[model samples]
Target chain A: MELDPKRYAGKRLLRREIPLSTTALREALQHQYFKQIPTLRKEKNILYCNRCNATQPHLQNINCQNCGSTHLYCRNCIQMGRVSYCEFFYEWAGPNPDWHIHNNPCAWEGELTKHQQIAADAIDQTMKQNGKLLVHAVCGAGKTEMLFQGIATSLQQGKRICLATPRADVVRELLPRFQQAFPTVTVQALYGGSPDKTGDGQLILATTHQLLRFYHAFDVLIIDEIDAFPFHADPMLHVASEKAKKQTCASIFLTATPRQKEKRQIAAKTLPHVFVPVRFHGQPLPVPASKLCFGLHKQLRKGTLPKGLLRWLHNRRNPTRQVLVFLPTVVLADRLQEEAIEVLLPFTQKILPKRETETLIRTVHAADKDREAKVQAFRNRETAIILTTTILERGVTFPSVDVAILDAAHDVFDEAALVQIAGRAGRSPADPTGEVVFFHEGRSDAMDKAVRAIQVMNRRAKRL
Target chain B: MNLCVGCGEAYTSRPSWSTFFWPERISLLCKDCEGSFHRLKDSGCPSCMKQIGSSICSDCLKWEKTSYQGVLEKNVSLYSYEPFMQDYIARWKYRGDYVLGKVFEVEFQKLYYQHFQDTKYEVVPIPLSAERMAERGFNQAGELAAFTRAKRKDVLGRKHGEKQSKRSRLHRLTAENPFQLLSEPPQYAVLIDDIYTTGTTLRHAAQVLQENGTDFVAAFTLIRG
Candidate 1:
C-alpha cells in the first residue's frame, strides 16, 4: 500500500541520520513510518558502511596468520572507517539533492582553446544526450579549464554534480579552485577527515573513495585523473564509482595518458573520446634524449657516480637551473644520495669552498616525513638538486627544471610515466626549453615510445 | 558477497544479513574458521563449569576444602578454551584490538539473557587496575558486558599487582586477593570476566563482594580453560 512515491521525492537523507539509534529506528518503523504494509521484511544482520555502502564482499577479513580471531577486521577502505559485519547502517530513505535553477553559477573567466572547446562541446553533448565521454588530453593541456563549461551548463540546468578523482591530493588541490569558480553554488568537498558532512550541496567534490558513500546521488559525474593510481588499480573503487551515480547519469573520465585497454575501447568506438594533443603553451612537449651511462649499480658499490652522470650534473646543476634525478626506487634514491654526497663532497668543496653544499643537495620519496616541506623548499630554489623517485612523476610541477632518469629501461618506467616525467620540464613559459636526459644501460621500447609520442605531439601541433 | 572477517575471503552462497533465529546479527567469521571454536558443554563441574570427567572437578573440590568453600556459587562459562580460542584471546587481550570483542558479543549476550531473564541479578564486570586500563585503553570484560541486556554495575576495583599470566600455578592459587569493593554491594550480583584461568581471581573478587554485603554471587566468563 505505497500510494505516494512522490511524497519522498527531493528529500535526501543518509541512512544514519534518520533516528537516534537502531532500536529507535526499529520502533519508529514498527509503529509510525508505514501505514499500509502490515508485515516487516526480515532485518539484515550484516553491516553496510553508512559512509561507503561496502557490503560483505567488499570487506576483507583480517585475522592473525595463526588461529587468532581477535585481530579480525575489514581490509577494504580501512584507511577510512572500518565497516564490519557487526557494524550497522541504516537505509537512505530520504529526499534527493535539492535542485534549483541558478544563472551562470560558474565565475571562472578563462577561455578554452579551440581544441579544448571541441572537447568541451563533446562533453556537453555527453551530458545532454547521455553517454560516457573520455577526455584524453596530454599533460598541461588545460584540462581543468575544459571541464568548467560543461559543469557550468549542468549547474545552470539545476543538476546535482559530483567531480571525483582517485587521490585526496587532487581533491585538495581542486577544492579551492572549484569553490572559487562556483561562488553561488553550495559545493562540498568530501574526503576522509573532511569536516563537511552535510550533504545539502548542489555540487560535490570528492575523492573516488568517498564516492562509495553515495547511491544514485549525482546527475553528472566527472572523474578527473580517472587513470591514476589506486583508482585504476583497485576494482573496489571501480565498483564504487559505478554505484555512486544515477543510471542515466553522464560519466566523464579525464586522463592525460590513456592505457592500452582504454585506447582499445576508444578505438573500438565503445568509449567515445576526445583528444587534446597540444599543451596550453602551444609548444611541443620536450622529447627526452637518452645517454647511455651503464653500471649505475656498480658505481654505487664503488662509491662513485658514472663519469657521464657526474659530468652531466656538473654542467647541468646551478643556482638558477634546478635538476631532478629520478631513481627507480626510494631505497636506491636514498643510497645514491648518500654515495653521491660522499663522492661529490670534495668536488663541491673544491668548486665552492665558502657555501654549505649539503643545502644544495636533498632527497625526497614517498615515505619522507618532510616530503611537502622539502618539495616546497626545492620549488623555492633553496635546493638545487632534488634526487627523487617516481612519486614526483605526475601532479607535481617544477618550473624550468632539468630531468634525468638513472634506469630509464627499468620495467617500472612505463611509456605513460616516462611521458609525464618528461612533461615536467619546460613547463614554465618564462623558460620554454629545458633538458630531459635519460641515462640507461640499454634502450627500451618505453623510451622509444616516449620520444616518439613527444615528436608526434610536436608534429600534430605544427599541423595546427 | 559475504567475506570472512578472520581471513578476508569472499563467500557467495548466502546473503550477509540473513540471520537464523535471533537479532544476533550475522556471523563475522567464515564456516571453516567458525568450526574451530565450540560452545562450552554443561557436563562437568557444577561450580566452575570445567569439563572434567567427574561430577566435581579437582579444582572445585579443592575450593570446597579451603576456607573459601561457600565464598562463591557455581560459575557459568560460554565457550571452551580450545587452542584457537587461546590464540584469539591472546591477540584480543594483549594486542588490544577492541573490534575482536564483536565476535563473541551476540552469543555471550544471548546466553547471559537466557540464564538470568527473570532474576534481578546485577551484572558487575571485574574492574582492571588503573594502570592496565590505561595501557589497554579499554577493559575486555566491560566491552563484552556492553552487549548484555542487564545493566552493568562497576562495583569491584583491583589494586596493582603482577599480571596473572606471568605468575606460576602455585603463586596464582595462593595469590593475595587484589580486589576491593568500590561501593555498597548488591544482594544477588553476577561477576563478568574474559576468562576463567584457575577461578582464583573470580573467587577473590567474590570473597571481597561477599565481605562487603548481602548474598549469593555467581560468575559468567567468555571462556574457561
Candidate 2:
C-alpha cells in the first residue's frame, strides 16, 4: 500500500503538532479509507526530523544546564522540536505528486540584457533537465534577474522551488523580489520566527538554517551566496540543504566569489557552470589601487590619522558622495571612531560647511543598535563617511560611494572580502567608476589577488 | 566505546584494588568529571540534608512557616548542585539524554536500600504533564527510580502550567495545586525528583499525597540546588 504524497505535500507538521496518538494511528490503520494507505516509515537509533528531514548523529546534543539532564534534548534543529533518543520522527514515502501544471506565473516586465538572457536560458534548460549548475556571475551582474526565468519555468511546471541563502538578511531582501516576479505562485519567507511556518507555499525563500526543517520538500533548490559564511564553512548546514531537496531535484549555486574547490571541479568538467563577467549596465568592475602607509595603527592609538590619509579624506568630501572606511576588526573600528572625532573633526570644521560637519562620521558594527537606520542614513547621504567592520562587506549597495580599506594587509582581509569590499564602489550606472583605495603597511598576496581577479573580470567583460 | 555520561568523552579504566573489591562496579564517568561532582556528607539539616551548620536548614525553617508545613518529613539528596552536577543533571532531564541516568545507578541504589529497606513505602516519581512527557520523552524522576528496589506507582499527576524552574521563588510558593491523585497511594510514600530546587515542588507534591490520606512522605533527590 502506497501513501499519497499529495497528502503530505507542503505540510510540515511536527509530532507535537499532530493532535493524535499511536492509538489514533492504529485506528487509522484499521479504518476502511486509510487502511490501504501506507503509514509512516519508522526509523530508530537515529531520530529524523520530519519537518527538516535532518537525521540523528547529524543532530547536535544540547544538555540543559538548568535541569541537569545529560542527553535531555536536540539542538541541531531544536526550533522544530526536541528530537530525542526516546522519540521517533516519521516520513511519508508513498507516492509522488501528480499535479505538475500551472498558468504563466511570471509577472515581471523587465527585460534582461543579451548577456543575461543567454545565461538565463541556460539556467532554465539546466533546471528542466534536473542538472546541477553554478551561476558564477560577478557582483552587480543582474544575477537575481537571471534567476527569474528559471524560477518562473519551475513555477509554470508546478514544481516546488526554494531559494535559499546563507544569511537571513539576504532572504528578507530576496523575498519581495521573488514575490513580485512570481505573483501567482505562493511565496513565503522561511527563517526563524517567520509568521507563515505551517502554510503551504509553492515558492520558499529561506535562510540555509531554515532548510534543516525541510526534508525532501522541494523539487528545485537554488542556493544563492553559495560561498558565503556558515553555508560555505559549516558541513551540517550543507547536509541539511541537500536533505531538503528531492532526490532528483536540480541545484543551482549562485556566487560572485567561487572557492578554489568549486573552480577546480568546474575546470575538471565535473561541475557545470555559466559565467557572466559583465555588469548589467555593460561596465567593468572598479579596480582598487594600493598605497603603502606604515604605522597607521600607532597613529590611530596616538589620536591622529596620517597626513596623507587625512588629506585624501578632505579631498573626497562632497554632499552627493558617501565614503566607506572598512576596518579589520570591531575594536579597531571603535578606537578609530574616537580618534577620528578628535583629530578629523577640527580639520573638517576648518574646511567643510556647518550642516555637513554635523554628519561627518558614524561608526557601525555587528553590535550596533539602529543598524538598518544607520545604513539608510548613509544611503541617503545624511552621513559623509561611515566607519565599519566586515559586516557591511557584502550585500550592501550605496550609490557614488568611495571605499577605503584601513589595513588591507591584515590577515582577516582575504581576497574574497577585498573583492566584495571593492565591489561596494562603482555599483550604480551613474557612478560606474568610484575610487577604491587600499591603505596598507605592506601589500599582501590577498590584496594582489583581489586586484588581479578584478582585472581578469574586466578583461573578460570587455571581450564579451 | 563506553563514554562518560557527564562529559561524553571515551575513558579507559586501569585495574585497581577498588575494582577488585567491587568487581561489579564500573567506571561510569571520566576521571576529570568524577572529580568534579561533590557528594554530600552527613553534617547538615536532617530535614533536607542541606549543608547548613544546624540540624534544621533555613530553607526547611522557611518551609515550615508556609501553609503546607510538616507534610514533607525529610529529603535525603545525594550530591550538591555544583556547576558540574548542574550540567550533568540538565543533560539528563531537559536534554532528554536518558542513558546518562546510568551514572547515578549504583550510589542511588545504595542510598535507597540503606534509607528505606525496612520501611513499607512506595516510590512515587513526580509525574510529568502530558505536554512535557511528549516533549521530553521520559520523566527524569521515573528513569532515576529504576535504580531503587521499592515498588513504583503512577500515584500523582500534575496539571500543565508554567514550569517551576521558570518561575520566581515567591510565585513558586504561591502557585496553586498542580498535582492530582491518579490512584490510591500506600500508607507511606517516597517522592523522587531530579533536583531539590527551592523545595516548593517537593513540598507541593508531598502536601497532595498527605491530603489524600498518605500517613507520611519523604523525598530522595539526585542533587540539592
Candidate 3:
C-alpha cells in the first residue's frame, strides 16, 4: 500500500490519482521489500489507546467514529453462564448443507446477530490489548464466538497459544475443531505422556500440568473451564502459567458460571466484559428434576444398581435420545458400570466401558481426558449411556443428552455441580431439549442450590 | 571413615580422587570389604543386590535397577550382603513406612541441633533417585526427610533428580548424575541417601550437588553398609 510516497509527498494525494510506471514501479517495489530499512531497531510495535490505558492491548479501531473517546472496552465480555460453547465461524457456509451438525454450534454458523458481532469485535479488542480477558455470557447464550476474534487476533499477533481446559475430555474433543480453525499453525494436543519437545508448535492445547514447562510461551492463553479442575485447584499449575505467560500476555477465560472473584472484577469495572443473554441456537438449557432415590449411593457401594434406578433407566431408555449417568465418584462409576453390563448384557453384543476417559486414567486426580472422552462417546452415539463422577457436572455439552445423576445427594453434587450436570442436556440446536434427573438418596443443600440456579438461569434466558 | 553399614567396612572419610579412583574408585573400599565384595561378585551381575559372587555381582555391576552392565559403581556390604541386609530393608520399606519417618525425623533433629548449631544444611533426603521413586511411589530418603524434623530448616531434599534405581551403579557413576537442589543450593550440604551399602548413590549426589555449588555434602544414611 505504501509505494513511493515521495511522488505524492509534495502534492495532495487521492486514492485513485496515484499512477505507476512499469519501469519505476519495479524499483520502488524492491525498495519496499529490501531497501527501506530503518537503522534504529524499531521498538516492539505498541499502540496506545487512552480509554483502555497503555497497559491494555490497544484496540485496532479505538474510540469508534461514533464514540470518539478511548473508554471503549466492552463490559459484556466477562459474564459467566450455566454452560460453555465454542463459536465456529467459517468463510464457506452454503457449500456444505450439513455443516450445522455440531450440537454446541459456534458463532460462525447460525444467525450472526448484531450483538454477537459486537461481542466478537470486543474480543478482538481484548486480544489487541494483549492480556487477561473474561467472557460474561449467560446460560444458553453462545459464549464460544466471543473467543474466535481474540484467539485469531492473538495468533495473528505472532503468539503461541494453548487452550487449557480442566476437562481433558474437552481438550480431546477440541483438538479436531481447533485444528480445523487454525490449520496453518501447528497445534499439539498435549496432556499426559506428552512426548518431549518434538518441536515447539505455534499452538499447544494442553492440560494445566502440561503447561508447567511453559510460561509466557503463548501470545494468547485461552483458559476454558478456568474455574474448574486442577487449574483452579493447584498453585503449581498457576505458577507454571505465570512463568509461561509473556509479560502483558493475552489471557481469555471462558466459564459458564462466573465465580465470585470474576464477579468482583466485573462489578468493580476493571475488566472488559461481554454478555450474550440468549443462546445463538435460540433455546434455553434444560431444567433437571430433583428427587431422593433412597439410598442410591449405598446400592452403588454394594456393587448393585438400585431397583428404582433400574426402573428409571428403563423409563429413560428409548432409541430416540441418549442418556448420561452422572455419579459423584469413580469408585461408584465402576460399580454402576458393572451393574449396567450385568443388566444390559442380554440385549447388546458389546458393552464398551467409557473409552476416552481422562478422569479414569489417573488414580490420583480426576481423569479429565477420560471424562471428556465419555461425553464425546455419548455425542458420537456409540455409547447409549456414559457414567461419570462430578467432574462431568459442568462445562461440557452434548445435544440430545438426557442426564441422570445417581446419588445426586452426595456432597459432590453441590448446587453449582447440580446446575452444571443438568445444563449438559438440551445443548443441541436440532433437538434443543432433553431431560435431566437428580436421583439421590435425599436432596442435599447442593441439590437445592443446583435446582434453584438452573431455574434462575432458565428464567434469565427467557427474559432475554 | 567411610564405614559400610552392611558389615561396618570403614575406609577413609575423605574424597579419594587419585588417578586410580578419579576414572574409577574401587580403592575407596576397605581391604576387607573390597575383598568380600569382589569375592561375592559373579558374571554379569553388577548390583550387589544381584551378585551371586561369580565374577561381578549380577545386580550391582549390571546397572541401577535397569540398564545392561551399567551399574554406575560397586558397593561393599559389611554384613551378610543378602540375608541380613534383606531383613532391615523390608522393615524400612514396609513396616517402617511411617515409623521410620519418626526415626529419621528424630535423628535429623538431634544430629542437626547438637552438632552444627552455627552452620546450616539443606538436608537433601537421598533421592531413591527417579527410578526408585517411580517404582516405589515415594522415595525412601525423601519420605524420611519429610518426616525428619530439625531446627532452622530450609526447604531441602530434591525437588528433582535423575532416575537412580532405573540405571545401574556404573552408569550413574559414569553418566552425569541427576540430583537437583530445590532451595538455593547451600555452600555446605548434607545428602541423606537411604543406606550407605555402596557409597555409589551418595557419591553421585555429592558430585552432582557440588557441581551445582553445594559444598561439604556430608552424605548421611541410617546404615553405612
Candidate 4:
C-alpha cells in the first residue's frame, strides 16, 4: 500500500526502500502479474515486406508502417519518382522516373534514384488525398529522409504532426536530424527519460508513453518501428495511438517485419501499397550458413558442451568483432554464460574477452535502460559476447555478425522471430555472409520455415 | 441622529417634490451598503468567462434557458470583486480559511439559500471536471458546499463539456447541460456556482441536472446579489 502524504500533513514525507523476500515477490507475481488484461481481438490482415521479399499476415489492429495502415495488405507499388533495384523489383515494382516533378520525403537529398522518387511521390499523393499512408521500406532504406518532405508539407499546411518509435535508440538517432530540419519548430524527443513537449513543436518524436497526455492533438501521425516491442504486444498503447489522431487526420506506418495479416490484405487488393524493393545503397541481401546442433539437453544434463561448439566459441573471441548469444529465458542465459566461461576462457590468451576471460558473456533485456549503450559497446568490439533476448530483433542492425540460438525448438522461436534473428546477420555490405547456428536437440517447423523464408528472399533478390 | 447621515445625504423617508429634484431627493445609497450592492454582480458570459456590458456574451448567441423562471441572481463570492473579492477567494480556497467559506455560506443562507428547502435541493457540487480535479487537487465548490451543509449527491458528473476558458461567450448555452446522473433523476434542484459573475457553469449544470429528473431549478453561490 502506498503511504498517503496528506494524512500526515505536518510530518515530512520520507519514502523508505522496502526489502522483500523472493517468496513474497513470487506470491505478488502470481496475483498481480498473472491477472489477464482484457484481450480486444481484431481482424487479422496481411502486409508485404520487400526487404525480406515475403508477404506475411498478422493482427490488423497493429500499427501500420506505411501511411499508418493498421489494416494492411502485402501488394505495394512505388509511384511518382522511383529508382528500381533488381532485388526490390523481384518483390514489388517502383514507378517510372520523372525529373521535373517534386514530392515529400525525397528519397535522396542530393541524388534521387527512380524508386526513391517513386516512394516520395506516392506519399505526396496520399497526403494530398488526406488518406492514411504506410511506407514499409527496408531497414537501411533511408526511411527517415523519405519522411522529411512529407513532414515539411504537412507543417507548411498548418498541420500538427508527431512521429513515435518504440525504441529510444532509434529516437536518439533521429532527434538530431529532426532538429536540424525544423530548427524553429519545437522538436522534442520523448523516451523513458522525459516528458511530452509535442505542443512546443509542430513536429515531435516521442515514445508511446509520451503519447498518453494527448487526445486528438495531431493532424498527421507517423509511427516508426510499428511492430516493435510493446506497441505490437500491448493494447493500451494501441488505443492511445488511435486516440491521438484527429478525426480527419491521416496516419503513416513504417516497419521491416510486417506481421502476417498485412500480407493477406495486400494479396486481397483492398488496401493500396507502395514498395521500395532495394536498399538505398542497393546491396544484395545477406545469406547465412545454418548448422544443426543436436542433443543439447543430453549435453547439458551431462554438464558438458559439444567439442565442436566449444572449439567454435574459442575461435570467435576476437578483438574486432564480438559475438551475441540470444536465449529464451534469463535462467538458461545466466547458466550458459557461466558454463561457457569455465570451458573456453582458460584455453585462450585473453582468458575473458574484455570483462572476464573465463566467463565473457552478460545477459541484457529490454527492462534495463543501459541496453542500448551496452549493445553499442558490443558493436564497437569491446566485449567478447553479449547475451540478449528478442530485444535486438528488428530495429538493431549489426554488420557481419554471427548469431546462435540455444533452443531453436522452444515455443518463442517462431517464424517471425527466427527471420528477425537471421536479419541481424549480414547487415553491412562488407559482411554479407555469416554463420547462423540453431543449437537444439531437435529441428522444429518454425526453424525450418525461417530458413526457407530467408532462402526465398535471397533467391528472389539474386534472380532480379 | 446626525450619525445616521451617510456621506453627506440626509436620511429621510420622503421629500417634497421640489427636494426630489436634487441630490437630497435621491434614495439613501450608503457607501458600505452600496459597495455591497455593487459587489452583487451578474455581468459575465459563462462560456468565455468574459465581462460583457450586458447579460448575453458574444460567443453564446443562445442562453441555457432553465425550466424554472427568473429568480434574480448575482455573484455570491465571499467579497466584492477587485478590492474585496480577491482576498475572500484566496482565504476561502487556499490559506486554510475555513471561516471565510463558512461565513460566506452562512450569509448565503440569509439571501439566496432561504428560497429552497432541503426537498428542493437537487444539490450539485460545482463539478471540477475530472481533468481539472487532477491538476488543482481538490474542488473549491465542494469545499464551499461542505461549509454550507449543501447536499453532496453524485449526480452531476461532467458530460463532455468544453472548458470555460477555451469557449467564446456566445458558445455558452444557458440550456446546454453537462452534468450527468449516477442514479435515477431527482425531482427538483438548484445548481451551485462558487463565483456566478457569468452564469455558464450554473446554466450548464442546471441543464444537465434538470434533464435527468429535476422539475424546478435555480442557482445559489456563497454571495450572489
Candidate 5:
C-alpha cells in the first residue's frame, strides 16, 4: 500500500501509528518525503528521547529481548509509545501543507465588550508581529469570543492554527464553539481517545499532550487554561508545545489565574499582557468570606455537621439556588456526603421525601465514573448540592449557585484554586451576586490572598 | 523523590515507626495506583487459583484427561486479572515499558518468599519464541523471575507460532505442545509466567519438564484470568 504524502507532510509519529508497511515507509524515505530520526540519542553517558524531548533521568535501560542486548527506553513518554534505542521516529521533510485561506471565515454574530475588544485587538497585533501575548481575564469573561477576530485574521493569512488547553474537558467544550464561530475552517479536536489523529485540520483544538505528535506544524498557537494541572506540573508538556510551533509562530496564553512565574514576567514587562477584571456579564468576581468553624474536623469525624455550616445551609439567603461544596480531597468529600446525609436527614425528611432527599445530595471527584452525568444532573437542578474536590474548581459554570469551600486551610486549596472556585458563583447576569463562603478551622495565607485578589479585581472593575 | 511508574506522579516517602526497625520498602507506585490492583484471595481453586470455588477448577480437571495430565501440580498467582491489571499488563508486556515490571518487585518477592521459602525448587521462566522475543524486546516472564532471588534456569525453548492470546480456549487446549526441553531437567521445578489464562501453556511446559525427569512441577504467575 502507498502512503499518503499529505498525511505525513508535517507529522512526527511512531511507525505503528501509521497504517503503512515498513517497505512503503522506506520508499517514502527514499523519495525524500520523510526522514528517520533516532528515537534515543546518547550524550556522554546520558540518553535523550528525540520524540518526547525527555532527558537522561527519564530514561531506563533493560535487557532487550529483541536483539538480546542492553538498550535504553524513555519512561517519560512510554504512555504514548515506547521509544527505545533501536527504534526510530519518522519525521516529514517534504513540502509544507498548503492551508486554504478563507476570505470571511468567522460566522459569529455577537460582539465583544469594550475590554474584550481591546484584548482582541492586542492579540491580533501580536500575531501579526510573531510575538507573545497573555490574556489574563477573569472566569466567564468571554475569553473565547475575543479569540475569534484574531483567529479569523490569522486564517485569512493562510496560517495553520492550533488552540491547546491543559484539560481534555476544556478542549471538548471549546471545539464545537470554535467550529461554529468559523464554519468554513476545518476544526479538529484531539485528546487521548479522540477519533481525529490526522493532523490535516486547518485549526486544531487539542490537549497539550497531543502536541507531542506535531513537528513545527502550527503557524499560530494559542494555549488556554495555561495554569491547569498536568500541563503546569509536567515539564515535558512545555517542551511539546514549544516543539509543535513554527520557529516564527505567534504564541498566546489565555488564563484566568496566572502562576507566580508568569506574574513576575508580566510585572517585569518581559511579557506583554492584557487584563480583563470584569466578567462578560459586567459583574465583579465574588469575594469569598471566611467563617471560623471551631473543631470542624472533629465534628466531621463524629459524623455530625458543624453548627455554623448546618445553620448556614438551613438559612440560605436563596433557598432555590443550588450549592457546591468543595472539599480538599476525594476521601473527605465522600465522607462528608455520608455524614451530611445522617446529620441532615431529619431536617430534609420534614421538607421532602426520602428518595428526593437522597437524590438532592451527591459527591463527585476526578476518578468518579459518573462525574459528567452527576454534573449534568446538578445543572438540571435534579441535585441541589454537589460535594466535590478541586476538579470542579474551574472550566465549569453553574449559574445561580452559591459556593462553599470546606477545610479552606488545606494545602490543596491554593490561592489560584480558591479564586477559581469563588469565580464559579454568580456567572449568569440574572443572578450576579451569588454568595461564596470559606469554611475553615483557621484562616490560611492562601485564603487571605485569594480574598484580597478578588477584592482588587472588583475595585478595578468599579473603575472600568 | 520517587515517581510512580503507573501515574508518573512524584512522591516523597514518609518514614514510619516500622521503617525505623525494619528495612524500608520503596514504593514504585502511588497509593491510588497501588490500590487499584486487587490481590487474589485464598478462597480460589486450590490448583489454578482461579476464583471458582475452593476445589480444583473444571479447567484443571479437563486437563487431567490429556496426555500432559498430572504433570503440572498447581499454579499460584498474585493478582486477579481485573481491568486495571489488564491495562497494566498491556503496557508492561505489549507496549514494552519494561520498567513497569519493577513496580511489582517488592510484592512479588514477598509473595515468593512466603510461598516457597521451605522448599528448594529451581525457578524456570517460560520462554518466548525467537520471533516474538525480537518483536516485544523483553520476556515478561524472565523479568518476573528476576524478582525472586532463587536460582533461575533457562532450559526451555519454544517454536514460533500464533500467540496464545489470539486463540480461543478450545483451540488452545487442542493445539500441540510448543515446549522443547533444551537441557537436563532439575529434580524440582517451578515455572514462572506473567499470566495463567487457560493453563494450557503451563501444562505443556510442565509436561516437557516431567517427561525429562523432573519429579515435581508447579507454576507461579503474576495474574490469573
Candidate 6:
C-alpha cells in the first residue's frame, strides 16, 4: 500500500507511527520528496536522538529486544516512542504546506490597550522581518490579545503559525480562546494525550513536548511561557522548538519573567524585545510583603499553623475574600489542609459570627484526581480557601483572592514562581489591590528578588 | 538525582541502612510508580496461578483434555495484569522503551528465586518469529529472562503468524502450535514470557518440549491476565 505524501509532509514521525511496509517506505524514499533519517546518530562514544535532539547523557545503551543487538535508545523522549539505534525517523521532504490566505481572519472584538497595541505592532514588524522578539509583558497584560494582530496578519499572508507553551494546561486554556479569536482558521491543540495527531493545522497550539513531532512545519513559531519548567531547564525542548520552525521563521518568546540568559541577551542588544510593564487594567502589580515567622517548618511539622499565618487569616482586610495558600510541597499542603480544616476553619468561623454554615477549605496538587473539580469548586465560591503547590502558580486566575506563600524561603519557590504566585492575585480590576504576603522563616535571595521585581514593575507602570 | 524509568521524574532514594553499604543500588522507579504494580496473591489455582481458589483453574482443566495433556506442570506469575500493568506493558513492549523493562529486574529476580531456585530447570524465553524479532528489535521475554543469573537457552523457534494479543481467546485456543524445537530439549525446562493471557502459547511450547522427552515443563511469566 502506498503512503500518502501529503499526510506525512512536514512531520518527523517514528517508523511505527507511519503505516508503511519496508518496501513501500523504500519506494516512497525513491521520490525526491521523501526521506528517512537514522533515529540515533553515533558520534564517537556518544549517541544523539534526531527526533528530540537528545544527547549522550539522555541516551542509554539497551539490549535491543527485536534485533538482539546492544543499541542506544533515547531515554529523554521515551514517553514518546522509544528511538533506538536500529530505528529510523521518517519525514516527507516535500514542499512546505500551502495555507489558505483568508481575509480579516481575526474575530476578536476587544481592543488592545495602548501598551498592548505597541507590542502588537512590534510583533507584526518582527514577524514581517522574520526576526526574533521577546514580549516581556506583565502576567495580566493581555499577552494573548497582543498576538492576535500579528497572527491574523501572518494568516492573511498564507503562513503557518505555531504557538507552543511549556504547560499542557496553558495549551488547553489558549485553544478555545484562539479558536474563538480566529474562527475561520484551523487551530489544532497538541499535547501528550491529544487526539489530534495530524500536524496539518494552519495554526497549531501545542505543548513544547509536542514540537518534537514536527520538522520545519511552521513559518512563525511563538513560544509562550519561555521560562517555565521543562522548557527552560531542558535543552532538548529548546532544540525541538528550533527544529520545528523553518530556517527563516520568526521566533517570538512570550514570558512574564525572562530567564537570566534572555535578560542578558536583551541587555546586550543581541535580541530585540518589547516590554509591557502595566497590565491591561492599567493597575500596578501587587508587591508581596514578607513577614518573618521564626519557626515556620517546625510549626508545620508539628501539625499546626503558625501564629503569624493564623493571625493574618483572622485579620484579613476583606474577610469575605477567598484565600490561596501556596505551600512548598504537596505533603506540606496536605498536612496543612487537615490542620486548616480542624483549627483554621473554626477560628475563621468565630471571626465571622453571623455565618452559621461551615466553609470549605480544600487542598489541591498536581496528582490530585479531582483537581479540576476542586479548582472549579473554588471558582464557584463553594470552597473558601485552597492550599496548593507551585502547579497553580501560573496559568490560573481567581478574582479578589489574597496570596500567601508559606515557607517562601524553600528552594522550590524561585523568583519566577514567586512573581507568578503574586501575579495570581490582583488580576481582576474590581479588586486590583489584593494582598500578597510571604510568610517565611527567613527571607531567601529569591524572595528578596521577587519583591524587588514586583516593585520595579510597579514603578515602571507608574512611569508609563 | 535518579530519574524514574516508569515515570520520568527526578527522585532521591532515602538513605537507609541498606544504602549505607550498597549505595550504588539506586532504584529505577519512584515510590508511587513502584506501588502501582499489584502482585498476585498466593491463594490461586496451583497449576496456572489464576485467582480461582486452590484447585486447578478451568483453563488448566481444559488444557488437560487436549492432546498436549500434562505438558505444563505449573505456571507462576509475579503480577496480576491490573490496569497499571496494561499501561506498563504497552509502554515497555509495544512502545519499545527498553529501559522500562529494567524497572522489574529486581522484583523479577526475587520472584525467580522464590519459584525456580531449588530446581535445575533450563531457562528458555519464548522466542519471537524472525519477522516479529526484526520489527520489535528485541524479545520482551528475552529481556525478562536476563534478570535472573541462569543461562537462557534459545531452544524453541516460533513461526511467523498474527500476534497473540490481537487474536480472540477462541482463536488462540484453537490455533495451530507455532513452536518448533531448535535442538534437543532439556530434561527440566522453564518457559519465560511477558504475559500469560490464555496460556495457549506457553502450553504449545511446553507440548513441543514434552514431545522431545523433557521430563518437566514449568512457566514463569511477568503478568497473568
The C-alpha lDDT values of all candidates are 0.74, 0.76, 0.52, 0.55, 0.85, 0.85
When only the first chain is scored, the TM-scores of the models are: 0.81, 0.83, 0.67, 0.67, 0.93, 0.93
Q: Native-contact fraction for each model?
A: 0.00, 0.00, 0.00, 0.00, 0.88, 0.71
Candidate 3 lDDT over residue span A174-222, tens digit each: 7777667656666778776555332146667877656544433556777
Candidate 1 lDDT tens digits, B1-225: 666655566654444444655434777777876788888887878778888874878888888899788887878899999878887787667755555677887889889987777567988888889878644546888876776868778888899999988888799988899998888888888889999988889889999989888498889899997
Off by over 4 Å in 3: A1-115, A138-142, A196-199, A317-319, A344-379, A394-397, B1-225
| Segments of candidate 2 deviating more than 4 angstroms | A1-7, A10-14, A17-80, A93-101, A291-312, A317-320, A323-389, A409-411, A439-442, B1-130, B138-157, B163-225
TM-score, every prediction: 0.62, 0.68, 0.52, 0.48, 0.86, 0.81
lDDT of 2 by residue, B82-179 (tens): 86677677766776565567678788889888788865878999888988876776688887776786788778988999988889999988888799
lDDT of 3 by residue, B1-225 (tens): 444322334566445455355433323335553344221222423333333455554334334454322212333222234444445455445322222222234434444444345556556666443434432334566554454343222323444555444567567557654445555666666655556654566666566656666645664455434
Question: Which portion of correct inter-chain contacts appears in model 2?
Answer: 0.00
- As for TM-score, the candidate ahead, 2 or 6, is 6
Candidate 6 lDDT tens digits, B1-225: 777877778887787886687664567789989899999988999888999878888888888898868888999999988878898899878777777787787888889988888657779999999988776677899888888767678899999999999999999989999999999888888899999999999999999989889999999999999
The CA lDDT at A338 in model 1 is: 73
Model 5 stretches astray by more than 4 angstroms: A1-6, A42-45, A302-304, A341-360, B1-71, B78-91, B103-124, B127-135, B146-189, B197-216, B223-225
Interface RMSD (Cα, Å) for model 1: 8.9
Give the Å shift of residue B137 in candidate 1: 14
lDDT of 4 by residue, A1-464 (tens): 22221121111111111123446534533544212211122234533332122232211121222222333322111111111111111100112111112224222245545666777777766765668666766545557767776776776666667898877777776777788766656577777655543234556688865564455566778888776776887655676677667678777877656677666776786656676555555664444344456677666554455565665665653324456667776556545656766664544335233354423555678766677677776666555667777777666667656777767678877877777776676566665555667777677898888777666655654564
Model 5 alpha-carbon miss at residue A212, Å: 1.6
Docking class of 6: acceptable
Between which residue pairs do clashes occur in model 1? A10-A96, A11-A94, A11-A95, A11-A96, A12-A95, A61-B5, A61-B8
**Candidate scoring better on TM-score of 1 and 5:** 5
Q: How accurate is candidate 3 locally (lDDT)?
A: 0.52
Off by over 4 Å in 1: A1-74, A195-200, A300-307, A317-319, A338-360, B1-225
Please give the lDDT score at residue A440 for candidate 3. Answer: 72
Q: Whole-model lDDT for model 4 versus the true structure? A: 0.55
Task: Please state what fraction of the native interface contacts candidate 5 reproduces.
Answer: 0.88
Ranking by TM-score: 5, 6, 2, 1, 3, 4
TM-score of chain B of each: 0.92, 0.92, 0.47, 0.55, 0.93, 0.95
